[model samples]
Each structure stands twice: as structure tokens, then as C-alpha cells.
Target: MTAPTLRGAAAFVQQVRAAEQHLSGADPVMAAVIERHGPCTLGATRRDPFHTLCASIISQQLSSKAADTIQARLMAGIGAGRRITPPLLLAASHEELRGYGLSTAKARWLRALGEAAAAGTLDFRALGRLDDEAAIAVLDALPGIGRWTAEMFLMFALNRIDLFAMDDVGLRRGVAMLYNRGRPLSDARTLKITRRWAPYRTIASWYLWRVADPVNEIWV
Candidate 1:
């Protein structure tokens, strides 16, 4: 089966090959993961920046399943086209938005995002031009978006290859399980271990996420 299209995904095969080779050689633990997983087809997606950001906001504290369910309901509520564009969100009344299973706060966040997009303050393309930290800072300034969310947007939406969210539960778990052998993970230790996969950490992350089930894969 084909992979789901991810935003800012690799268009050049050379880089991906280099990433895999780097990870394989850098850490034996990651090498085992890559050998088992075969390839890193990080979840396929084709969402635009604004749409991806909206999804990220909805996903803030919810499980992937819960977030997907609410987003589905919201898109269905919007119309048959199923596009969550700024204009569509801006056109909906706040009450109408909440009725789609979003919390009152989430509704406001959606409105804020919409307002940003409509006002030209949220330029998706411009984000690509900024370095990861600067771009993350820009996104962090937005309501409801934090370092983690901005990192995600940069990694997935902007298709940056080097970012690694050290604080992410999954990455932390992956590190502990594969390298530490169930020992407690400290921030400094985690940084030391993961930095070896640097410059290709995102790809390394994909393999790490696969550690629990090398035979089957899911983006979460």
C-alpha cells in the first residue's frame, strides 16, 4: 500500500537515503529499528499549513483518535467540500463552531487562527523561509500554540528533517525503551543519546516510534 502524503515530505530521494544511512551508522539501536521497519514512510498527508495547524490545535491534549473524530465532525459540519479553510471557519458563528464538538476554548482558537490567516498574518509559505527556532517562535506567539505544537508544525508542515521534540512522550519512551533498558530518563541523558541522530533526527524519530511494533506502524 502507498503511504499517506505528508506535508513537506521528501521530494528528493538523496536526502532520505542519507538520513537512513546516517541513523543506521550512528546508533546500533536505531539501526535495528531501521532494518526492522524497512523504510520511514512517516504518515502520509497532504494538508496545507493552515489546515495542518488547525489539526494540531485540535490535537493539543487529545488522543489522535479523539482529535480525528472531532475534526471529522467539524469538517462535515462545515460542508460537503470538507475543506477547513480560513474563510469557512471565519464565516461560521462561534456557537455553530462549538456545536461541532469543539470546546469553547478550541472554538476561540480556531477563530484566532482563521483571523490570522484572513489578515495575512499567518503566511504558511513564509514559515519555510525561517529557521526552526525563529519559525517556532512565530508559531508560539499564536494563541494555544506552544513549543511542542510549533515544533510539530515545523517538522511536519514545513517538512524540516532535523527537528526532534525531546519533550514528546513517545520520543522519550522510545529512548528509554531502546537505549536505557527501562532505566529512568533524564533530560541531559536524553539529549546526549538523541544528539547522535542529529541532522536526521526526524527520520530517526520515525524509526524510534516503530520500536514497539517493528512489523506494524502508525504515526502516533
Candidate 2:
């Protein structure tokens, strides 16, 4: 099987800078966000498709810190010098998976993913050729993955530029804080604001994540 092409971390940063230049020119509100945050520092991890999907599954509806802990525990149990593959998860009983702090639903999803992988139903490589919406549809069809999770997979996993997930609470909060004085916008209004960030919305979304950070000082 051909390995998925992975970019060096530097390449992703270069893309961010390029995106920032466009964003700065296109939207002043976003320009302020860029000025405050400086460069986009969204790290590019070279995780394989299955591993990335597994992490995404683990992260669903959970806070980042909690999700990381659960993912770490499960990975540790998979043993040293081993990758997460179909059989490894297929061999894991649901009870064993739950012991790693996965909810019953998440554990079932993981096993379902394993089953799909083993059956050659979910072809990670094939996803590379599909357009964003198409790829998202395929992933969304999977038992537990939702539109938000699929959007995240495209943004973080595949590193597709220009993806925006309006339903994400953080992105919504970021949009509200920046453009609406911390008042939430309806999805339609939010979409209007995000449209100007297009073709670089992924990078824009990265800054939104920063703008919505509670620890960051309020924007003037």
C-alpha cells in the first residue's frame, strides 16, 4: 500500500503564513486576530489514516485533555513497538476498550471501525481522491462519526484548506467573540462572516480557536 503523503511541519507553517496574508487583506476582523495570535502554529502530525480516525473517534464530545488521556491509555495497552491496526482492535473486547475510559458508545464505534477496516469497506487511501464533501459523506456514514467529526478529519487529518465547521461550539464562540461582541450569531450570519475567509478558512479557523481561548486576554 502507498503511504499517504505527509508534509513537513515547516510546510504547514508556510501555508499558514500565506493564508494569513490573504486573510489580513480580506477581513479586518480576522486581521486583528492574526495580529494578536501571530503565526498559525497548528502542528501537523504524520499519523496514519486509521490512527488519525481512531484519535478523532476518541476525541468526540470530550475535552482535549480528557480525550488525550483516554487515547493514550488505549494506545499503551496496544503494546510497545506496535501500531493500531485492524486485528489489534478486533482482538480487543469491548470491556477491555472501556477499561481505557471509553464510553460504551465510543468503544462500539472503535470496534465498528475495526470491522470496516478488516472488511475493506472504509478505504482510507481512496478518500484522498474524493472531494471534501464526498469524503465527509463517506466518513459520516460510518456508525458513530458525525458531520463535525468528519469536518475535523478533513481539517486536521487530511489538512485540507478552506474547511469550515459552523456547528463547532469553539468556532461559533470565536466568531461571536470577534464579530458580534461575544454575542452568538445565528448559523446563517456566522456563515456570511466566514465566507470572506474562504480558500483559507482552515487557517482562519485556527486563529478562531486561539481567539476563543479563555486564558487569552479579551480582545479590545
Candidate 3:
């Protein structure tokens, strides 16, 4: 499926609202969560899933500031964002990426992503066709990509409504605090409780992340 345009996305929002209503009727948890959290922001993106996924991998395990800096360096390395193709990424030496502040593992993982894309093993165009689980399975097959990464891909790149990154520490912590629990929410427990949110789990997860941001003193 082609990426959603701004107009198309508005339509999708309407569709989601309808789905939310239906799902809410079936499951009150979903209705309540949607009422609290509203819509999940699917940012406007001209880039395809390939670029989005590549960016996400580059951002992994790094602070947002560090990720932005590395991304800028890599963009400079490629000369222009337009040249950030699979071959260019594959051709970029490990030393080159390291020079741009990438760890050895991150460079290797990026190369794997490039190689998979080049080999037709990672098809950005076909990503929309796959169900959430299948899409995640395909992504996790790559090096350096874990469930969190796959879940991020589903939530952001795929604009999947039902997906949530349960393994995210920030989300777990946020949810734990939200419900006024003394212990942090375990992944298994998060899954069980999240059943109520159903199709809007991603939106709920976003709020949870915001609520957990230490710099903002949200949890306090």
C-alpha cells in the first residue's frame, strides 16, 4: 500500500474513530483509553518505510540528542539525504560510520539493514500488506532489530493502531506510575492490562512515554 497522504490520513483517522467506537463497544477498556488518549499522531512523512526503518535503527539505544547528531553526520557522509540509498549505506565503511559516532555494533546492524534491503529481503512497499505479527517477524529477522524496534516500526512506519512497544522501559514505567502501582509494570502484566486498550494501545503507549519523561518531571 502507498503511504497515507495528509488527506488520506484524515480519512484513516475517521476510519480509526469508527473502529475505536466498535472496539470500545466490544471492550470498554479500549473506549476508556481512547477517550483519555485521543488519536495517535502519524506524522507527515514523505519518506518511504525503508528510510523510516533505517532512521529508526540508527536511533536505537542512543539518547535522542545523540541519535540526531549521528543522523546528521551520516546524512553528511552520504552527501545528501537523496543519496541515502541501500548501495550507499552498504558501501559506507564501518570506520566511516564510527567516525560519525556510531558504535561498532550499530554500524554492523546498519550494514545488515542495507544488505537486506538490497537483497529484496526487506521490502518497504510490501510492509503494508503484512499483518502486524508478520511485519514484526520480518523486521526482527535482521540484526540489531529486536521486539522493541519491530514494535516501533509497526507503530510509526506502518501506522498500526493495535501495536504497542511493551518492552519499552519508559512505557512500562509510565504505565506503572499511571495506575499508581508501587512496582513497575512488567511486560507480561502490561500485556494483560493493555487488552482493554485494544486498537489504541499505540496511542496509550505514546502518552505513557510522555508521562515518564524524567526531564519533564512528569512522573512526580
Candidate 4:
């Protein structure tokens, strides 16, 4: 398959610069993180909504390696292609999907997602036009999708720049390390701290994720 074009090249760089400046000035802890991490290189990999959401489901609660294994099996089961569309996923049986290493519940969720896509109940095209809240609502309304997952879709799929996923464990842990001196902060406190990130919280969140796992490569 042709390589997917990188989304929002000039705009993403500008946002990264703006976010780094704001974050560095607003909080010394974040400023240090910025200094260490240098320029934010996070950018959305071009993916259709269906495959992105499906991949998110596959990734839930699994280590990156494990998730990649399951996803590879799933793709091989469906067909030998980088893209996994709703029609292709729907063509597979539940047992077949389960054999691809998905838990039964996740297999069901994938099927439900496929059905929704097939029926036009979840309009991929329309989602791009909706604002963050509305788009999140649409994603969260699907079976097995939650706020975190929806927010991930926003950051990694839609490339929305302002999202701060308050419930992300890595973000919270990173915040604690950077701001709270290695103590986990309450969700309320986390949100309060992240408020300064504003308009560029997604970029900040990427740095925090990096802080949380310095050895692991972060994928968006």
C-alpha cells in the first residue's frame, strides 16, 4: 500500500512550537520536560476512522507488543492489507475474530462497530465535521467505546490539537512525576494542572506520555 500522507505538516509544527512555549512558560516542571524532549514530533498517522477505532479496541489493556501481535493476526485473518475496513471486518465471523486473539467481548464490539458502519449509524464522514464534544459523543455512544477511547480517536485520528485525556493513567503518572514529585494526583488535580496547557494539551499530553515511559516509543 502507498504510504499514508502525513496530516497537517506546517500546522502541526506551528502548534508544537506554540504549545512548547506556552507549557514551558506556564509550568517549570513542564518546561523541563520540554527541554529534555525537545520539539514535539507527534503527528497523526493518516488512517480511516474504521481501522483506527478497530485498532484502538484491539490495543485496549494490552502491551504494545501484545497488541501488535493481535492486530497482526486480525489483519492476516481478515486479509493481507494494512487497511481493515468495516466490510472486511464484517465478513469475518465472531469465532474467527476471537481466534485472532480478541476476547469475546472485544470481538462482539468490533462486530457491532462494523454493523454500525455498514448501516451508516456511525457516519465517518460526518464525524470529521463535528466539533470535539459532538464527535466524542458519537464515538462514546458506540458499544465498548469510552471517553478515553473517544479522546484517543480525536487526537490520533481526527488530529484535534486541544484534547487532554484526563483519565489516561500514563498522563496522570507523568503529571505526578513532573509536577507532584512522584505522587499520583487526583483526577481533579490533574485536570487543574493541565488547564495551563490549553489549546495545545494534546501536544503536552504526548510529552507526558513520553515521561511516563521514556523507553517506549509513543505511537499516535
Candidate 5:
């Protein structure tokens, strides 16, 4: 199936409100979170999939500020006249990429992703035509892309409405706080609890992340 049609901000806000209403009816615990958090700011920011994936790789095990610093350096190194295309990335040397603060493993992964793009093995344009599971599978097949990273692509890039990153520490913590009385939920329990939020779980996940760490901005 093709991806869901992208909506403008106004339309998306209305959609989120509707989802919240549905969630409130389905789960009282989550309802209280919505009530307390007021409105969610889970708007999608469209990005080139390749670049976004590369950014995801760059962000692994790093803080948001550090990731931002590395990404800025990478963009500068790629130069102003050129776009951050797969070919440009493929042409960049390990030394150059490492200079931008990329670890050897990450630099290798980025290059491999670039090669896949150049060879048409990973087509960004066709991603929207895939179902969520298929899209996640495709992304997860990449060298450095894991299930969590792929789920993130679905949430932030394709704006998929139903995905839940069950392994995410923050989401688990938030679930524990809201439902388990401030103790972290086991992965199995988290999965079962999140089932009720289906179709709007992405929105629910956003709120959970917020509740887990209200002070820190989650960039990944």
C-alpha cells in the first residue's frame, strides 16, 4: 500500500486532536497524560531519506548536541554548491568523513548506504509506496540501521501513525511512570499495553517520550 497522504500542519493538528480523543476514550491512563501534557508537538519534518538515515547513523549513542555539531561539520564539508546526494557521500574519503567526527564504523556505514543508493538497491522515492512493515524491513536491512532507527524513519519521515518503538528506553520509562507507578515496564508488558493505542500509537509514543523526560528534547 502507498503511504498515507501527507497533511499540512493545520490538518495534522486536527488529526492529532482526534487521535488524542480516541486514545482518551480507549485508555484512561493515557488520557490523563494527554490532559496533563495539553497538546502534543509531534509534527513531521520532511527530510531526504538518505540524509535522514545518515543522520540517524551519526546520532547513534550520541547526545543531541553532539550529533548536531557533527552534522553541521558534515554539511560544511560536503560544500555549499553540492547537495548531500549519495554520489557526493560515496566520493568522500574516510579521512574526510572522520574529520567530521564520524567514527570508523559509522563512516563505513554511511558509505555503504551511499553505495546502496547509487546502485538503486535502496530507493528513497519508492519508500512511500511501501507498507509500514515493508518499509521498516527495507531500512533495517541496511548495515547500521536497526529496528528502532527504522521505526523512527516511519514516524518522523513517512509520518506513519501506528508505529511504536518498544525498545526505546524513554517510551518504556514513560509507560512505567504512567501505568506502573513510576517503575519501568517490561518489554512484553509494554507491547501489550501499547496495543490499545494502535493506529495512533505514534502520537501516543510521542507523549510517552515527553512524560519520560520532560526536560530534555529528544532529537533521535
Candidate 6:
């Protein structure tokens, strides 16, 4: 697959700088974040869609380091230095997968994903062709997947250019700090504030993640 670019990031900053000079509700906090962080971009791993989705599941609510460790263990068990395949995962029993450090829920989710892939129900190729809404709808139809998981699939796996996670705690907290607020910003409020960004919200979202998570900035 061709690599995605952050051309949107640079353009959004230019637009924001121009808009803030005239607009009343432009996020000055976001402006300051761009100024401090320089230009941000999509830093997604170059993995296949299925693997990326699996990685996203592993990452849910876990620290990045912990997720990586668990994923490494699972992968090593599934395929010895080979690609992650549905057949390989299905070959392992539930207890075997759980022994690799997956919670009961995550192990079930992984099994369902593998079953879907094997049955041709979860078409990664078709998912690649889907727009943001369609992709989310398809993924979230599965058990154990929700809106946040679907959004992560869009942002990281499909590399959708126009998406953002309003519910992201890091982004909200970062926005609060950048704006000199004492409390975390609410998702509803953040969504309202991000309107000026429009189609470039994904780029803005990247900046928020970076600002909100400095220790993990290396990943951004």
C-alpha cells in the first residue's frame, strides 16, 4: 500500500493561522499547540489492515508499553516471525491465547475477529475501500467492538484523513492545558471547538494527541 502523508497537517496550520486572525471562536489553545509542536503527521505503522485492527484492540485502555508487550507475546505465539493470519490465531485455543496475557474479553474479541476473517465476513479489503462512516459501521457490528475501537481502526488502520476522536482523554486534557484551563475539556465542547478544523480535524487531532501526551510524543 502507498504511504499516507500529513500534507493536511501543514495546510491546516496555515488555515488556522489565517482564520484565527479574523475568527472569534478559533481555538487559541490548538494554535499554541501547533506553534510549540511544529508540524504533526500520521505516524501509523505499515502493517496490513487485520494486524492493525488487532493491534488497536490490544492497545485499548492499556499503556502503550503494556500493549506492545502483550501483542508481542500473542504474535510470537501465533506466528513464529511470520505474518499474523486468521488461521494461525484460530489454531490456538482460548486458554492458550489467555496464557499469552489477553483478558477474557480481549481473547474473545480476537477469536471473533479470527472467525470473521476465516469465514470471509470481515473483509479487510472491503474495509480498506470504505469511507469513515461505512468502515466504522462494519467494524462495530462485531461483538466487543465499539465506537472508540472503530474510530481507532479508521485513524490508524484505514488511515482516514478527516477523522478525530472527540472522546480521547489525552486530546481533551492537552486542549485544557494548552488553553490554560484547570480541568479537562469535555468531548461535546471539544467537538464544538474543533468545528473550524472541519475536514482537517484528523491533523488537528494529531496535534492534540501530541500536546496531551508528551511522554508518548515519540510515537506521534
Model 4 per-residue lDDT at 35: 92
Ranking by lDDT: 4, 5, 2, 1, 6, 3
Query: Higher lDDT: candidate 1 or 3?
Result: 1
Q: Give each model's whole-structure lDDT.
A: 0.78, 0.81, 0.71, 0.85, 0.82, 0.71
Model 3 C-alpha lDDT per residue in residues 53-150, reported as the tens digit of each score: 77788888777777878888897896646536788787789899888888899889888888888999888778778888888888888898888888
- Give the Å error, residue 77, model 1: 0.5
**Stretches of candidate 5 above 4 Å error?**
1-11, 80-83
Ranking by TM-score: 4, 1, 5, 2, 6, 3
Name the better of 4 and 5 by TM-score: 4
lDDT tens readout by residue for model 1, 1-220: 1112433244534566789899989888888888877866653454478887898888888977788898998888877264689988888889988998899999999999999999989887677788888898999999989999888777666667888897688778888888789666999999998899989888887776677445433353
Root-mean-square deviation of every model? 3.8, 4.0, 4.1, 3.1, 2.5, 4.5
For model 2, how does the per-residue alpha-carbon lDDT over 1-33 read when each residue is reduced to its tens digit? 122254455666677789999999999988988
lDDT of 1: 0.78
Task: Tell me, by TM-score, which candidate is best.
Answer: 4
lDDT of 4 by residue, 120-182 (tens): 999877888898999999999999899999998888877778899888888888999988899
* Candidate 6 ranges beyond 4 A from true positions: 1-28, 80-83, 217-219
TM-score to native of every candidate shown = 0.89, 0.88, 0.80, 0.91, 0.88, 0.81
Q: List the residue pairs that clash in candidate 3.
A: none
Q: What are the runs in model 2 whose C-alpha is more than 4 Å off?
A: 1-13, 80-83, 214-220
Better of 3 and 4 by TM-score: 4
Give the candidate number with the greatest lDDT: 4
| CA shift of 164, model 2, Å | 0.7
Q: Model 1: how far is 143 from its true place, Å?
A: 0.3
The list of candidate 1 runs beyond 4 A from truth reads: 1-10, 80-82, 212-220
